[model samples]
Target: MEKKTDVMSIRVNEKIKEKISKEADSKNMTVNTLVNQIITNHVEEGTVFQDLDFTSVRKQLLKKLFNSMPKEEVTKMAGTMCKEFFKDTTMYLYGKYDLESTVRTLESWFNSSNIPFKEIKSEDSIKMVIRHRLGSNWAMYFETMIKAVLEELEVKTDSYVKTIDSFSFRAYY
Candidate 1:
């Protein structure tokens, strides 16, 4: 352990202190170490910063531009980009990407990228529901990404509905 450089103190309710101590013990950590880590994380990274804020604005602007393009053209372009990103997964997937595993991978990607979606899988089909906050264009963009990934995996969609802020898609294996 590193030597302490500075000391600080604050008062907390007895119940809160007890809860924190119990949590630390449950995790097999010292209360002081757990509290210090929590405080450090709060100070160092409180929330999404300026760049992420600007990213949403940028997406809005780009969506407007892409909306002017032909729908098929824009979707194809987005699909092409997704294909490149997922191309190297051949070895990881053991040469073929099955429908459930492929969509599961997409689900994980959506989660880590902060895209809100609900995916339900069954033996026959997979349903993907996306609640896009940006706009219809972004929703369509994700739909394109999905269609492209399914295409790459050799899965075909049975039905799909694209609206202004949500995408409901069902695909078969």
Candidate 2:
């Protein structure tokens, strides 16, 4: 079904308008479509970063930090730091903490962090693969963080795979 939309007019600087028009033409889309996409993204996902007070870190710095930490320390920090934060953020964003909200929140964070991820859904479970170049310690950190969130939500993990540059898991809902 098509979504309903409303029409409104707003003014922009002439140069900004020209840039946006050029970008829209280059992308083979109308100005209206590009503007709608930008607004939708801000409303649906960008607010999370704004409201959560997220900070940007260089990948090399994060890589060094993660690599220096012991595996056990990485696991402990990931669990302790992410569990309640994830739960609270999910609740605040979606009005409840469930698998769908959790997954959506994760996707938003991955997107904002410039991490590539793939999600596959089936009748009974959802599988996610996060490909990050931050190394095995980072993978361990993500695995622990995700596992903590799943445990808090009472979800069961069917399988988990971790490597130097990627982490994948299947969770039964």
The number of the candidate with the highest TM-score is 2
List TM-scores for all candidates, in order: 0.53, 0.82
* The 10-residue segment with the lowest total lDDT in model 2: 81-90
lDDT of 1: 0.67
Give each model's whole-structure lDDT.
0.67, 0.89
Clashes of each: 0, 0
lDDT of 2 by residue, 87-106 (tens): 78888788888899999888
For candidate 1, write residues 48-166 as lDDT tens digits.
22212312345466667867777787678778865655544422433456675566555544543456888787888778887665566666777777777777667878678878877
Candidate 2 residue 93 C-alpha distance from true site, Å: 1.2
Where is the poorest 10-residue window by lDDT in model 1? 46-55
TM-score of model 1 (CA atoms)? 0.53
Top candidate (lDDT) = 2
Return the clash pairs for model 1, or none. none
Where in model 1 is the C-alpha error above 4 Å?
Answer: 1-73, 89-96
Clashes of 2: 0
